[model samples]
Target: MLKQTANMQSSNWIGHFIKITAALTAVFILCETVLYLTNPNNRWTLVANTSLKDGISNSLVYPAYAVDVAFQDVEEYPLTEPLIVNPLPNIINDVVLPQNDTFLPVHLVRFYFGLPHGDSHSFCWIDCISILSIMLYVKPSKIYIHTNYPDYWPFGRCDMITDWSLIQLVYTRQRFHLSGRRITFYKHEADVTKYSVAYQYGGIVQDSDVFHLPKMVELLRDWKNKKYQCLLTREDHFMNSGFIACPKGHPYTHDVLLRYRDDYRDPPVLYNSADVPWEIYNKNKDYQKNFFVDYQMGNHSWDYKGPIRYKEIPAWHAYWHGCDENEKNTVQLAKNSTYWEMLHFILAEGRKALIAVFPTTVKP
Candidate 1:
């Protein structure tokens, strides 16, 4: 009878141990999920203190890897991913556009473009010229060209960095998701960073399509001479980002860029690259009095109304649909601007097919 009692006690002890082990495992998993949701940027909190006045690129964990992580993992972990800013190259060559990156409190300008990791592609000829032209037109004290392919921008006129990592770090640091619904895309990467740069550095952030015009040149020069904390122009409703200027560490930029996700999530329309920053302006009161709705500053090369002013001088030009290749637009383009000038682009691009089919004769 004593032996039988001992066997029963041993079996009960084994069952209790199994239950304890399973309970501990469940607890561990629950704790991990909580930690991930609460502190998505990780325990490090690297970008929380990013005054942005002093870039901490030197401190990026693995400079290049941060960009690689953005490209690979953005779709999976949009808001919570941790990213590092790649270090800027030590030596900038002379051929670069502007001589210095003033890193000034204000009068800085930034632009963004998407390219493959390296300089392997044809690197669209119009984009090359248009981008360089926009920078010169702004005449900024400091210029930042945000791109995935830094290799192509070696000339040193602009400080080139990976915008992908920049935007990711901003979202994670700001906890931007709480603002409402967070959406990520090829265009948002450029659009969001424009806000970040304006908040941190206090400068202009323009689109790649814009070009130099006298009005834009005058405004940029004004920032250098005296007291202009920030300047943004808007149409009746839309806030045009083609030209924006701000004082370094502006409160407006902080609220719009960082705290946005905390209050409102739904924008009437997405802030896609083509449209304006209307979402932020509409939601935030601080932005209204500080920024203005100016016709000249917000003027487009071609308005929704379509009284084409391409031939005339404007603050900045947006060749908005330079890519439109419809057969009908071909003749209208010739009437509006210099369509005949681009017939060469067609021949240059289709040379391989043209040669394969008509190898015997040269077109007379």
Candidate 2:
């Protein structure tokens, strides 16, 4: 009778322990999900659902994986052929072509990479939205996406994207040719490539994160008539490398490239790109006229930390509130938010007026 009672007690204890373990596991998962959803950076990982892979070259380069992730249940969305360029030509040694006298060639350049943990397959909705903004506003002749992995094209959300012909994937070498030099940080690599591409192509180089505005078109048109070799924007007191427009063989861009090639070392200098331009601008006061630094252009509230003085809603609020764990819910929220409003404005009257009007002072 005692043995039976002990057995019953042991069984009851085991059941209780199992229940407690499961409860803890559930709580942990809930916490993880909440954290991931709240963080904007994690949205790409959530949407892609891709296994993180090391070394971009080792991964298989195919559109099938992208299509599967981007268009899983949508039957109406048809597959489209993506334009890709394998083994991008070495333009480093090539002579800088003469500037296009009529207008800055409508070529737009952007660099995309999944570095630190190279997952070439990962792309977010914001990336697509940014591209769409550029397409709608700037209407570039060609949009070059310089990437380490050439095979991986972001076609997952092609249904939302309009022009496939505008996008061309150019494969860039992981190492620089100066004594076979390699950049330790991917950000530096982007800095070097931006100048190189601008030097070679003689167009606009914009960061992938920035959304192009309608006024940008007018600004570019105005730049063509001016004598400035490059047009740069100011973020706070320093010059930002985010948006740059210059002609082919511009001396300013060439100088920036030389700085990176000669001065850049293993322990990377933080903000080397931004600093180079800022220093150059200050040192050569006479040459300042050659570079147009617009204080108002590209300035937005996203990076601003000041109190809410303006009626315009902060971009962070729009993005964060609109994001959700469910892809459809996220999409729907984005459509209803200020982001969609801006896109619509760009589409409707972007050619005639500015989509975003920023107050001169957001600082407290």
Candidate 3:
């Protein structure tokens, strides 16, 4: 009787072990599938077709927000060499572009916001650092800033960031924080129309909150010589104004700014428009009547036509933006992700250095 009881116990233990192993294996497979399917690059269909656009003649082709996946793959298995950021040698040739200097070099710009006015200082500062890490990595030539303020405050306090001169460039602030920066931003004016007046030549504009990957500058230089006068970025099915490139004084710059301003005037009845899916800007009533009218330049739809206008360039960071916790996590994860690692390699030898960040609310 004792032997039989022991045999039963052994069988039960083995059975439980097999069940546990199977469950773990299933989970591993599921996780891999999820990551693969959701990867932004894997879904190439999400990007607009490039073949239809005209190529720049004698101009260097600067790619926007686009990263080659193979480059990222190689970076994952880096050799023992110490990691350092450096510019690619002969970037003009490596990127496959003829040199043209008639056009001024384009500078891609983005800004960083810590949090809404009323959020906890800890949360807001963490948010600011998360953006700062990526900005330090990109080291852009121009930066525009928008934040909240009591107009002035003690150093280290959350509202202290309102001092715009700290970050430099053109600065503005919202009247209230609870207004939601996006809504408040829509209410204010955009500098797009003032490109000619503000800049000697046109430069690119990128939303400050987005993160970047490697060799982005090379891509920008590559297309500079191209005939296209402007470039727009897309996130899957949506076209985003967040990333834009135009020559100084280009007509499109003024057009886009004027259109956005008009939209802000009456605003699309946003409260009634929540049902529109994320990234579908055209479907929004305000955008439909104004921004989406022209399909060739890029319509209101998320997935517009290929090879944007001569005034338009391809945009890469179309999939990410805004301040939701999930969006913020993705941005943070990217801070240490393989994407930025390659950038660290490419950025190691660049000339630009750290600049002071000023509060936006304070006037010069």
Candidate 4:
């Protein structure tokens, strides 16, 4: 009887232990699920069922990641999603063309076509974006682009595109021949930075991948001639390097070159080399090398900087450039259809606004 009683007690204890372990596992899973849902950029809907409004609150925790995930989804799957972007009118249906008497703002355009034969792929997209941006956001005097294929520009849409402005050190007859890799990626971008310094035009230079938003010109106008050399915007989670505003010839462009040269000499010494995070970019030697390191003196200026001012107008915008199989599939799909339409819709609206706002007193 005693042996039988001991056996029963042991069995009860084992059962209790199993039950506790199972309960703990269930709690852990539930907590993890809740955490994931709270992240705005997690794309929980892609994996589980969730509404965007509910996701918005969760987005506060992982704001950058949440935004990136949300934008990526919107950019890729715009067709399935609603066309209602709050606060901004839909351009496709309500395009506002310029009236008979009004002129447009002095246009400012720049291009980034670093990839060779990238003109057809990257540069072509940039030209379209530039035209669309000029039409929608601000009136540019002329959009200047730096590419090997200037012949491919849509001259019908643009008024004119003059010759290249900056000195071409890499492609010059004998100045300094760049390796194929540099030509493929960094050469044209470096040239654009130089051009921004050399040209006195107040327009910003941008990479081909940028997508413009409404009120972009107003933002630039607000920052004109204050002593800050360069201005940039934020993207989903980090600062977008593209879309910088400066006079035709800003002095800091030279600083950019010096930093680039130093970076080349010591790969780990500069900001965000071809491969690294912003943490590396901020603390690197290049930051010190820059002439405009003083924030008070107004050397480094950006629309969004630091943790406090994170929600201002995005200075550097991010598009659906995806990584991984799932993300790539979604990104490519949206790039084909929904992305262009929404972008064009925004552009059309902006053009009308530009026409209404363009300076009538200035000469064409």
Candidate 5:
């Protein structure tokens, strides 16, 4: 009787073991399938190998996905060959050109925003207005928003934007974190991303808080004509990285990237984005002459009660500074302010008209 009971117990144990193994195997297969479907590299490969038209269609279907997936892959796997510098064509003197004429080569405007703590994905009124200003004034071929979280769309005031075709989201990893430190600053990560994007793709890198003006068009033309390696703006006594424009494979941007990679120090030291560029400016005397630096780019005063500089209003920062966090209040302020009329004029009469009939002072 004892031998029979032992035999039954052994059979039950073996059956349970087999069932557990099968369950684990099924789980593993399911996980692998999910990974294969969602992996960015695999998706990028499938899209990149397709025809150009099909690739564009696929990107349009998912606007928030990384449009520069191939670039991201290249970064992951370092290229052995030297980086190529494609010379940009000069802009024609006349603004209006023939239908077949290509004005510039793929002007890419980039903005970087990081969502570290998984906080709100919604953009503030200031951000919305700033982007709207860029779309209206800069007339970029494409605007890429590089962020750690690519799934940040459909939140906040994005509905306010009418056109979604030109905008894209790119996934980027944070580069400025200490090995064992728990603290990370979003500002540093943004700095690194902007420099990297400018070096890799060659275009304008703008801060979310800064507004674009018609004057920027002229600066871009100068960049192309003079063959300036990079463009920066001066705010007060120091150079501000709020706005940076460069062509791909420029040594200026590459130097900034190298500085970040090698000399990046944790917070409290505070010298990465604007400071590094300023340092480069001081070190290289010729850089000052070669790189275009405009004083009017970031001239907006921080104090809400301070006088508003009419001339510097185009590339102003923090237009909604002093307004309540409520969106309605912001909208009302805009309607009551000269900015409303200014925007209307730009949209209706066009940027050229606005520049021709420049206003000295605007009343709220």
Candidate 6:
């Protein structure tokens, strides 16, 4: 009887061990499947983390707010080593076709803000820092700033930026049928219009909040020589609309505008401004050939390997919800050594740094 009882006990233990092993195996497979289905080309996807140490990109971040997946299996362009870029300055409104070495000849750096006055303006010093950074690095022949409050901050200060002027940028708002209702968002308007405006005008369309670095000068200059028609980047899983550059009359830029217009021509909008441009480009073979991998040009600069060329809102523009957390992040990044170094330290330390300095109830 004792021997029989011991035999039964050993069998039960073995069964439990097999069950646990199978469960763990299934979990591992599920995690890999999720990663495979989400990223393009099965390459690295930018997952948000506090630091660069460890393989965070490969790990499942499983962010509560982040579940949106886009354009799976699409091959992404690769960014070769940085070359010495030179922005061939074209005469504003009179772009000269290069007789010999006319690559990406664009001299106008354009920025637009709908409301520049009253409490609704929402332009803060952090915003100013980004714009100032762009102006200092890009070194464009002419800077065209379009704002409702032409008399406000950056308009009259031509001396502040290298070259500055005001242009009347007006757009008739269009309604989109999204989430079972007609909606009009400023970002949506900026999305389609940016392509249209940039195509005709011939320049770089930059957001007011896009921070620039000195290293970007050479990269942009080299891009001109490479015959790249347009350079766009991804913010997380979607192609970002906040920053884009194109020489005058680039076909890719024109096609993107047409696609966006056609998609919303009727009803039931599928993609947002950021996703729309990417979808259009992904279908085109020619555009892919001229593409470049730009880690720094993206909304999240610290995710990839490069100098932090641009500064953007971490998750979304509305992530902070006016709770002062955004400002805290901005302030934190501004301190210490180079912006890159400061950002690296903050990301590595994660919530601890936030708690130490700007102790908040908010949890990362």
TM-score of each: 0.47, 0.56, 0.35, 0.39, 0.59, 0.48
Tally clashes: model 3: 46
Error of 6 at 41 (Å): 46
Question: RMSD to the native, candidate 3?
Answer: 23.5
Pull out the clashing pairs in model 5. Answer: none
Question: What ranking of all candidate models by TM-score puts the best one first?
Answer: 5, 2, 6, 1, 4, 3
Model 2: residue 285 alpha-carbon error in angstroms: 2.9
State residue 172's C-alpha deviation in candidate 5, in Å.
1.0
Give me the candidate number with maximum TM-score: 5
Winning candidate number (lDDT): 5
Listing every candidate in turn, what is its Cα RMSD in Å to the true structure after a full C-alpha superposition?
Answer: 15.6, 14.7, 23.5, 22.9, 12.2, 21.6
Local distance difference test values of all predictions, in order: 0.42, 0.51, 0.33, 0.36, 0.54, 0.45
| Model 6 lDDT per residue over 31-138, tens place | 878865553323332432222123222234232111111111111222221211111121122433342333322221232333344434444434443444544456
Can you write out model 2's per-residue Cα lDDT over 274-316, one digit (the tens) per residue? 7777787788865586777876544555544334211232111
**After TM-score superposition, what is the CA distance of residue 297 in candidate 2 from its true location, in Å?**
4.5
Which whole-number lDDT from 0 to 100 does residue 264 have in model 6? 49
Q: What TM-score does candidate 6 get on C-alpha atoms?
A: 0.48
Residue 200 in model 2: lDDT: 52
Distance from true location, Cα of 332 in model 2, Å = 7.9
Candidate 5 residue lDDT tens string, 214-250? 6666666667676676778876656676677876556
lDDT of 1: 0.42
lDDT by residue for model 4 over 1-364, one digit each (tens)? 9999999999999999999999999999998888656533243322212232334323221221111111112221122331111111111123222322122222222332332232234324324444455434554543444332333333332222222232111110110112211323343334423332222233555554445555455554554434344454433333334544544323333234333333433223223322222333355564324312212111233332322211223222433332221222444444555444444445456455545556473233
Model 4: runs farther than 4 Å from truth?
A: 1-127, 154-202, 225-229, 234-239, 265-316, 319-344, 350-364
Score candidate 2 by lDDT: 0.51
**lDDT: worst 10-residue window of model 1:** 68-77
CA shift of 176, model 2, Å: 6.8
Regions more than 4 Å wrong, model 2? 1-122, 176-182, 265-269, 297-340, 347-364
